[model samples]
Every structure is written in C-alpha cells, then in structure tokens.
Target: MVRKEKLDSMFNAFSIVSGGNYVYVCDMKQDLSRWSKSAVDYFGLPSEYMENAQSIWNEHLHPTDREYFNESINAIFAGSDNNHTLEYRARRLDGEYVVCVCQGVVIHDDDGKPEYFCGSIKNHDSVNYIDDVTNLRSLYGFLDDLKSAFWKKQELDILMIGVEEFSRTNDIFGYTFGNRALRKLGSLLLSEFRCEGQVYRMDGTKFAVIAQKSSIQRLSEIYADLQETCAKEFYVGSDRLTLSLCAGALHLERFSVSPDTVYSCLRFALHESKGNHHGELFEFQEVVIDESRNSLTRLNEIRNSIVDECVGFELYYQPVVDAKTEEMCGAEALIRWRNNDYGLVPPFLFVPILEQDSLFPELGKWILREAMICGNRIRAKYPNFVMNVNLSYAQLERTDFVDVVLDLLKATHFPAKNLCLELTERCRLLDVKLLQNIFVRLREEGVRIALDDFGTGFSSLGVLRKLPIDCVKIDRDYVLNIQSNKEDRNTVKFISQLAEAFNAELCVEGVETAEMRDMLRKFNVTSFQGFYYSRPVPIEEFCVKYSC
Candidate 1:
C-alpha cells in the first residue's frame, strides 16, 4: 500500500500538470472529497472541500446516470474496488448535462481497503490519454509518460504484460468479445496496482505499468498477485475463464540510458518469457561484458525477426545443374537476413550464431516448410527438380524434428522424394546413433540426405561410412582452386572416388569460372553449384533463370 504522503505527493504532482484535467481527491477515512480549483470553478461547487461529497456529487449527476454513479462509488467505499473508472453525464453549473470520463485509483491501507482516492475528471472532447475499449490510459499516454519519466532521469521500473494465446480468445469468441476480455484484464491489472497513475493498455493485446515510485521488488510482488488473479476464473462480460499471463520487467536505477534501448531489451525479455520461461516473468539484465552484451542484443534481434513471422529472413535458391546436361536439376535453399539496420546479412554471419540458439529449431522449421512449399510450386515447372535444405544441429536435435519434417511435407503436399536434407560438419557433434536413426527414418520416407561440406569435418571419412547419405557435396575449398592447384585437383579426385564407393552422387561446390567447371568434369562430378550457373536467388528468380 502506498502511504498517504506518497499519494498526496502524487496528487500534488498532477494538480500542477499541464494537461487539461480537473483533479479530485477523496479521504475515505474522513468521507471528505477535495476538488481542484479548475473543477470547483467548472462545476460551480459550493466549496473546494465538501462534506458528504458523495451525496453532493450524486445530486449533480445527470438523472439518467444516477444509478451507475451510485453503484461505482458504492463499490469504492465498500472496499470492493482498488480502482474506480467510469463514464457518465453530469449536470454542470449551467445546468447542462455534460458527458465526463472519470478515472481514479484507490490507495490502500495495510488491510488493502481504500484509504484515499485521487482521480481526474476530463470532458469527452479531450480523451487522447484514454483507451476507448479498456478505458485505461492508451499506449499513446503510456509512451508520453514513459518519455517524461525517462527524460527526467528518474529511476524507473516497468512491466510489460501479455496474454498468452490471446488470438485463441478471439477465435473462440469473436474479436468484439475478445476486446471486452482485454478490457477486463486491463481493469484487473489497474486494480492490482490500486492506482490509475501507471497501468495502461499497450498496443497489440498487451498491458503495461511503468512506475517511478515503486521499487523492482515491489513490482515483482505485484506481478505475482496479478498472475494469481488470472489463475482463478476471471469473468469477461458474461463468460468466465482463467487467463494465461506472461510479463517482462526492467529496473533501471540510473538515467543514463535511452528508452529505445530499454524498449528493445524489455521486448526481448518478454519474448524470452513466452518462448523459454513458460509464461514466467523475465527481467532484462544489463550485461557487464561488452562482447556478451553485443552478442545478446544481436541474437535478440534475430530471434525477434523469427518471432515476427520470419520477417527479414528469406530463402535464396542456388540452382544445381547436372554436369553432363549443363542444365538445372535442383536448387539449394539458402537463407538470407536483410536486417533493417545492417541491410543484407550473409548467411555465414547469422546462421552460425543462431545454430546454437534454442529458437534456431523454430527458424529451421520455417526454412524447411518455406523451402518445401516454394519447391512444390517449382515442381510444376519441372517434376524431377529437388529442393535441398541444410539442417542445423539445433534442428537435428529437436525430438519432434522428424515428425515436424514429415508433417510439413504432408501439409505442403510436396513430394518427399523431391526434398533433400543436408548436414554440415557441425552435425558431426551430435550422437552418431541419433544421426543414423534420423537418416534412416527420413530415407524410409523417400527424403534424400546429403553431407554438406563433405570434406570439411574432422571425421569426414567416419561420417561417410556411418551415415546413409545419397549425395556428397564436396566442400567449395577444393573446387575453388582445382584448375591451378594439383592438391585441389587430387582432393576433388579423391572425394569423387569416395562418393563412388559410397554410391552417393558427387556435387562439387564453388565451380566459379568455366575453366573450373571444365576442370572439375575430369573428376566425374555429377552436379555443379556455383556462380558460373547462378548465385542463390528468390524462388521467382530461380524459376526464371533455370526455366524448364
């Protein structure tokens, strides 16, 4: 509970605020109400301080609105409410009925009953701070206060609350009902805080409470209560059910930071809560290590893109042509991320960093489903064309990976035989037994498997002997210099011979110039993928350049 002096300090702070509002305060113990000078002048009140204020206010309420006003106030004095908010018509000094929006919060005593109530009354014409649906302050209002607190360099703590599976709510009961549910949630949060000073309806089915007066520890306690309140049956309009809530919090002690940075970190924290914490509150920690901080921030952005429906990340297809026909036979789907700040980021730069991240499996699934669906479209042009996707170790280890793959194939209606999953040297780190099991299962479903960067891993020979792969993608290193270096030529010769022994097709990578392509022909390479044919491109461009 906020002490009387603190609430009084807050009321005084608002009384001098620039916004056009008529502030009011109520001492629940004394049953006395105090109106600001503006409110007294506008209402033509008998005095600034009124005895039996409720009865007096009730007398001035528009006749038709008397019932609602009485009930709302009755709820407050009865200790049934921690916050008060309503809209109604009230008769003014000129005897004109004016629509007014009243929003106030109850500051509690030790027993959690309202000790004081401080709120503002504003005319309907100036409601920019209020959210139409929730009646709590809008995101605009939240941002305005956030900026104000930030620029003032005050110590701040903020909680970003999101309803898990809220779209399902909309699906169950149309969006109109979902909005009502959201309003109920907003009111619940506002009540838990027992104040209208900070709680706000954020954009996109989320809520926020930014506080300079509350400590991080206090916010945590409040969040725990909010979570508990959601666990019980929460009535929304008429329907009642439990709401799943997740929150991300940040505590900043100093003012030497940017709100934009805080906003990103807080959002990242929320994403972490939803994705990894099972709806638990996650607090963004300031990293002391420079390298770790940069890495963390970079990965956060990448993960954010993935969560945003795989935005900024796209598949680029590189055509693989049969060496003899010198025509495209298949295409390898490579991913490229075009970050807003960094532009087109190369795959090597982002993929390696993400391969170890837990979210990589999700991104990997996106890549596979996207590649398969796109490849399915291309099969219309050429029935035998294959689409190859590289499997990250992160994806390979997911327990549901095989099931996910098979399900995607069925859903996308892409032929399993037209798809190939490639494994790089990193896949060597996974258990050989697991790799063998996955390879066999996929092969049984008519999906081909290939060892990418075949000669790059330390255990290249071991992987070839143990894993059942249909193709050996010779590392680009050997092919890059085959025309000039005898060792490169010999290495290509050795890999080709090994492919023959393993009965796997040999696809030499990095066959850049015509000279290199021709030089590689001596080694009995079955396919070639390099700039000489085409660099990786979008699905539409791939079809155009390698048209059937």
Candidate 2:
C-alpha cells in the first residue's frame, strides 16, 4: 500500500513537470527498456505494446524523416555526441501527422557500458513553424539563413527580374487579378528551381534569385529559360495578359569587397537595365566599379558639404540672347562643384546624383538665396536683366518652397519679375494641387516660372495647360539637329506652336552654328542659349563679358 502511494506521488510530480508525463527508454541496440503509462496513452497503444516498441515508433515516424532520424540516433550510439535533438513529423493515433521536437541524453552503467537512453517529445507544430511570406515553402527561413551567413562570402551573383509597369496593371485591372498573377509567377519559380536554388519576393513587382558559384554558361541558360517562361501570357480570372521583365545580373565575386558592395553592384546593374529603352538583361561589367566608386565618393562629398560648410559651391552663368535684338537679355544660373581634390566636377555628372539623394531641398534653398543676391547685384548695374535658376523635382514637392522664394525676394530686394524659376516637365508630374497652389502664389507675386527641358517627358502638355508657366525652354536634343534633320525641325516647330498657344515665351537651347539659329528663327523661337552665344562662364568672367 505504501509503495502504491509513492508511485502515485511520483506520477503526479512527473505530470506537473513535463505537462505530458510521457517517457520512453531504449538501449543502444534498439531494444526497449521501459515505457511509462503516459507513453502508452500518448501513443494510443495497448498495455502489451512494449513487446513491439521499436516497430511501433518506426512506423509512426514520417517516411521522409525516418532515414535522417535513424542516422542521427545511430551516430549518437557510436559516441559521436552525448546529446541529440531532432525535429520530425510523427503520426498521431488519429492518423494525422504532428510536428515534434525530440531530445535525448545517453546514460552509462558503472561498468562503462551503455545502460539506457531517455528522451521526451514535445509538439512543435505551433513553435517550429515559420511564417509564410511567399507561396514557396521554407523560402523565408532560407532567406533569413542566407542573410545571416552571406557576409562570409566575398562576392555573390544575384538575378532580379519582375513585370514592368505593374502599377498600371493594378490601376487598370483589380488588385485581385494582380495578386493572382504574382502568385502564379511565384509558384512557377518554386516548382522549377526550389530544390536547387533560392528565390525571394523582393517587393511588389520584383523577384530575386541567388546562386552560389553558378558557372557563366549555367547562369546564361537559367536566365534565358526564365525570360522565355516569364514572357508567356498568364491567365488570371479568364483574362490573358503578357508582361515583359527587365533583368539585372550582378556577379558579386568580381566586384564586391563588403556586404554593401554586393548590393551596390546589383543596384547599378538594375539601374542600367531599367534605363535601357528595351527591357534587356544587363550583366555586371568592370566599368561599373569606377562608376560606383565615383558615385559613392561624390555622394559623400555632397553630404559633407551640407554639414561642414568648409567646402563651398561655385555658380556659373550662361547668357541668354534675344533673337531679334542679338543682345544679352539674361543668364541661367548653373551650379558647379570644386572639390579640393577633384577640381571642377560638371553639373551633369553630380546634379542627378544630388537629386537621387534628395539633397536638392537643402541645396535648392542655398542656390535660391545665392542667386537672389547675385541677381540683385546684376540688377543694380542693369535694371532689366534676369537670372534663371533651375529647380529639381524634389524641391518642387516642398510645401515651404513658396515661402522660401518669398523670403529670398524680400531679403535681396530684387525685382520679382527678373527672377525666373526653371522647372522640368518631371516636376509637373507630382501632386497637381500642390503644384498649382505653389505656382499660383509665385505668379501672383510677379515671379516667372519656365518649364525647362520642355519635350523630354510625357506630361509636357499637361504642364503647359495646368501650371502657370511664363516660358518654355526646348531641350537641346530637339534643337541640336534642327538644321540637319527634318524630324527635329518638325518637333521644334510643334513645340514653338504650343508655346504660342499657351502665350508663353520660347527659348531654344543648343544653337552651335548659324544654320541652327536660322532654322530656329523660322519657328519664331526668340531667346537662344548655348555655345553659340557663350559657354557657361565663372561669375567674374560673366560680369566682364555681359556687364552693360
């Protein structure tokens, strides 16, 4: 009776500690030593189950996991390790499989012979499962591991491709169709290559694949096949639609020295492919090294210039001449960088980089104030002269841009009519109401706004009709070949007529020769700017060259 009472207490204690009170003991020779009452209950076995314990356990294990489990157990018996832990799917009594984590430690007798092994199993269905981010099984976990271990490699090759202009599809069709199309693409990739490679849904409209030591021939074949597969039309909810993908391939081993280096190389390749008129695949080349290094160096310098004030920026002016008067009317303000080491980096090379960095908002404010002061000095000498300053898309998006202009105008006391704010067609593509309010306020204050690079982007017509623009400057590409190409002449004529319809003045840039000027004159383009008049000159030289 006392022994029975002690056994009850032990069972209750075990239940409280393990929450299951199930235990199984087996020898290294695959013989069962003991099984607790809770073990029989857990496996749903009869009291006579001890006789066939090995077979019962083996039969319950998932076929896919059985071989690995046996190998791990055998290794532990061979004294490979003292403790073993594994996760596998085990068949429950009801015939459904449950994921379980099992851990065991070996015990030895006084004679140094293996006595028995004890282990407990825990339900891992809730704990070990990974959250799904894509349809591909185990993809997120794989990516997490890769991101953690990727730093060990000096280089990596990455391929990123996705449907072009997916946003338009989402807008035209419903988002449900767009999501179905994306899922179909994901499933296709998973079924094709998940066993041999890793895939990631980088973001909306983008997918990436990573390959380690993939040979050039193999990579080419893979890319060609993917391109062909992605090109095929997909049926989403009975509508058949085809989409083209732009692919960028970067070979990390060749260019990457650090973790960030790989990302940079891949991004540069992606940028090149996107900028191509055709959706072509671009491969990493050595030239990208120099280009990337230059970009990084310039970005760092610009960032430093913003904070330190030790480095300063220079302003160059190019004269704008009146067609009929053949005299200087105004000059456009151009920004140049004069690094102590690099010495005079052109605006073309650095301006776009600055825009991408969104440094233009601060840089734009500085340029405005400086240009106002400079224009005030020029106006003191020549009252009717004007100064045009170019503004970037980022600067236009600022709610405070109008206030900044007003503050500068008040501080400098320059005539508002003589200050021209130049904006590209791209700027007008932003929020319409914000642009309208800003332009209306500026125009009401007597400040003139010109649409620079007039024929470049898609929104030119909308810009002229909507924004309160005072002038339209035709881009140089349309003006350069006007004398030799009929197509260019026709384009110039169309733009000039549009300017007339809008009642805005026209400025034709890039007039290098007399023939170009004559051709422009035929279109009634009055204001001209380019090397034909004078190359952009330093402030001192410009003052001497155009001072009246």
Candidate 3:
C-alpha cells in the first residue's frame, strides 16, 4: 500500500467528472465505498461514505434482480472477469424502480489481484427505456427519444447497424452465448459513441445510434470507424469472433413526417445495405420513400380488402408435372391481389406484411376454401391429381385451423386425398411437436402434407425426418442454378436421397427449361413445377390448358 496517494488521486478525479451520473469507488480489501451524492440520495443510502456499500446497494435492488446482482458481484470479487458491467433495476428514494446500467472495471494491484472497483450508474426511465438483453436503450426507447427530439426540432441523424449471420452464430453457439456477445457489442458501441450520442439495441441483431446535432456525413465517418472496429475479432469470454455489420442512416431534418415514418425509411435502407450493398452504408433517399414503400397505404388496402370478402384477392394455379410421362400431376395454388390503384400487386409486396397480421387467418381461410373449390373441378378430370396450397404460421397457430381445413374440404365436396397443404418456409418457426401433431391430424383424414421451400431455412433434413411429410418441394433457389452451381446440384441430390429415405416424394420447383427437368429427373425427383410447365394461371385457364 505504498502507493496510497496515487489511489486517492485517482478517486479524486471521479469527483470532478460525475456529469450528473452516479460515480463510486470501492476499496475492495477494506469493504468500504465512497459514493457521489446523487447515488447516495437516489439509492437512499444512509451515508455517502460507508462500509459494505455492495450489501447496501443490494438491499435497494428490485426483488427480481437481487439474486442476479449478488451473483455477479460475488463473481467480480472472485476475479472471474476483468470488466464489471451490469444492468438491473434499483429502487429510488421516491419509491420508484428504475433500470440502471452500471459499468466499471476491476483494478488489479502489482500482484495481479483485485484491489479496487470503480463505476458509474445511469438510470434509464421510460423516456430512455433499456433492453434487458444488452442493457442498452431498446427500440421502444429509441422511438420515444426520437419523438421527443423531433418535436423539439433538434436536428438528428440516425444510424442503424445490423449484424450479419447472427442467426447462424446462434445456431452454432446457442442463444445464451449469442446474448452475451450482444451485450459485449453493446458495451463496445457505448464506448465508440459515448461523447457523441445515445446508442440503442434494436430488435434482432440490429443497433441504432441517435446523435443530436449530428449530420449524415459525420455519422458516415463514425460508421466507417465502427465498421473497421467490428471487422477485428472480439471476444465474449474465451470465444473469439469477428462480425460484419451493414449500416443505414437517415437525417430526420430531411423529412417532415413522424418518427415512425422516419424509422420505416431507415429500415428500407438497412434492407438494401444487407441485400444489395454487401454491408456498405445505405442512406435513405426521398425518392426511395415513394418507390420502395409505395406507401404503407397497402397495409390499409389489405385490411379493407380482407374485410370486403377478399375483393381484390385471387388464386392462380401452376402445374406440377410427372417426371416420367410429363403429364400434369398436381398444381400449386399461388395468391394474387389486384387493387384498382396498383393493379396486379406482387405477393412479395403485401404477403410479408400480412403474414403476422390479425386479419391473415381470415385471408388464409379464403385461400384454402377457394383452392379446395377449384381442386374439386380439377379432380373430376384427374382423379389422382394433388392441389397444393401454401400454409402460413398465422393460419397454423389458430386452434381452429385443423377444423377449418377439414370443414373446407367437406363443404367444397373435395377429396382429402386430392389436396396437399404445403408448409411454407416460415413454418420452421413452429415447434416440431406442434408441427408433427398438425401433420398427423391432417394425414389422418388422407390430406397430404408437403414441406414447401425445402433445402432452405433451419434444419431441412431434420424437418423432413420429424414431420410426416408426403412430399418435399425443393426451393427455387436450388433449381434455378442447378445447371452451373455444383453446390446447388449436390444439395439437390442430397435432399432427393434424403426424401426417398424418408419415404417422401420429391418435387423440384423453378424448372424453367427442359434441361433443368432432365438434370433434376436424374436426382430421384418425381415432379417438377416452374415456368417450363406453365406460369401460374387462372383456375379456368389451368383446367383448359392441362385438361386430360
């Protein structure tokens, strides 16, 4: 303890720079701590300088967070980690609980043993909500603060950074590790923009920065530095990894709309950053606001159309042909929407928005009923033919879903054997047990189940094995490049073999040419569906074109 004066001098520095935050220094060996007045008063501590400050602080912790806080403190004292960062709820003097972020580091002596702990605490209220996972401001907080700043007319620049391949990381390392890595990244971002702005942890591997009085040019420069930092490998515990980040930025002053509108534009920019720009920064342009969104007015149109008996909605059928005889064996029902204003709007434009929508179940029921009605017409000619209709998670989640399907089949006078319910790629989100039960119930009635967009999404083989599948429809991504992509061809062959092993027939989608058909036919696929067979047409047109 010969350098006692040096320790005192360092502690004195915190007094000068508390910056309206709670600053504290703990003498680990002595079990004493000195807190700034704000911390003492807010936390309702008995004294500014006191023994057992940790226990005193612990007493004020929210009941739900007390155990976690105690465990972390014990680990810190045991010298398990070099950094001390925690987020927890603490009771305030006003009898209110506030989410507080505590950040500090363990100061080691010459012997490399823990000697002191120093930190600051920032209380985040509703105006600056906090994320429990990362301890950063959450997207809700981002919107809250953005609205406040916007109303005040404070010029602001918003920057969004999305982590690439985060899902793959979670799949490999598990969600517990993914959450820790996100926390580490959040702290890194805090350090990067501490003096300049507020950083937020947005939903799903995306982070946002909102700096008052900042410009796009300045934010762009900041993003470059952040991108460079992320390129270098970082560690959460002993695990090391490098992250690729794509960025999107919006200058709020450039638009006169609400904060939500501004965020919508920024989201579009981030999508471009990931899909087209390969992690480069994509800025929101005024022209894109109109062209890309076509206005979210479509969301309104969808709701209204669903209410009006699905007025603008239509279903088109594309044939799935037999590999051996080239006869039309089945058809996939594809949904179409045609508004008077937009005229033939793409499914990609509205389907995604409505997939989780409350009205989707209603719309989904409409598609199934219509497909069954039309399938009845087709089955009159082709008795053994199958009519495939895509299923959505929204529809599947309903308790009445299985009942709806059975009722539609009976009401339409359609044979269950002639209809196949193809599970869309998103159905991967459902629990395996739930999916199995649904598939089994449908199969009990002789209705077929096909896993749509096979060889894509999480656990393709696993899904095929777990579910009672009658068919596996290969995704267009694989079939489109089967001619040149060796990996694609190998994947198709592997899936085909796997399907056969599971006693499931294989159908290849995106067969736009005869060569593709010949190539895929060599791989044990029984059916093909694509432009080569025929683009999806009206049900009447399908009957006339593929008539027996």
| Best TM-score among the predictions, by candidate number | 2
RMSD of each: 18.5, 15.2, 19.4
Ranking by TM-score: 2, 3, 1
Residue 360 deviation, candidate 2, in Å?
A: 5.0
TM-score for each candidate, following the candidate numbering: 0.50, 0.58, 0.53
The residue-by-residue lDDT of candidate 2 on 1-548, one tens digit each, is 54334434543444466656355556554454345675566556665225446556777888967876777777767777677766666777777776666777777767876655666677644432232435543333334334423424434556766577787777888787778777777776666555435666754576667766564355556766766766675666677777777767765443223223334445445555766535567775543325345454454565568555425687888989998786888889998878766678777765654563445678888888878788777777778888999988678877788998898899888779999998865464467777789889999999999889888863469768988988899889997777678999888888889989989999988888888887788886869999988999887888887663
lDDT of 3 by residue, 1-548 (tens): 64455556656887677666688888888877778887777768898778888888998988867876787788888889766666777898998887777877788888988888887887776444679998898887787677556435677878998998888779999999999989999999898777679999988999999988667888788778888877786788887878899988877653234555566557667867876698889986533335434344555566678879999999999999998889998998999998777778767766754664567899999999999888878888889989899988889888889999999988988889999999987666577888888889999999999888886664466777788999988889887888888999999999898889999999888889988988887789898889998999998798889773
Better candidate by TM-score, 1 or 2: 2
lDDT of 2: 0.69
Q: After superposition, how far is residue 115 of candidate 3 from its true place, in Å?
A: 85
| Model 1: CA > 4 A from native | 1-296
Compare candidates 2 and 3 on lDDT and give the better one: 3
Model 2 residue 34 CA deviation (Å) reads 52
The local lDDT score (0 to 100) that residue 504 gets in candidate 1 is 94
Is 2 or 3 the stronger prediction by TM-score? 2
lDDT of 3 at 331: 93
> Which 10-residue window in model 1 sums to the lowest lDDT?
287-296
- Kindly report which residue stretches of model 2 are placed more than 4 angstroms away from their true locations once superposed: 1-153, 158-163, 168-244, 249-275, 283-313, 352-354, 358-366, 394-416, 425-446, 455-463, 478-494, 513-523
After superposing all C-alphas onto the true structure, candidate 3 shows an RMSD in angstroms of: 19.4
lDDT of 3: 0.81
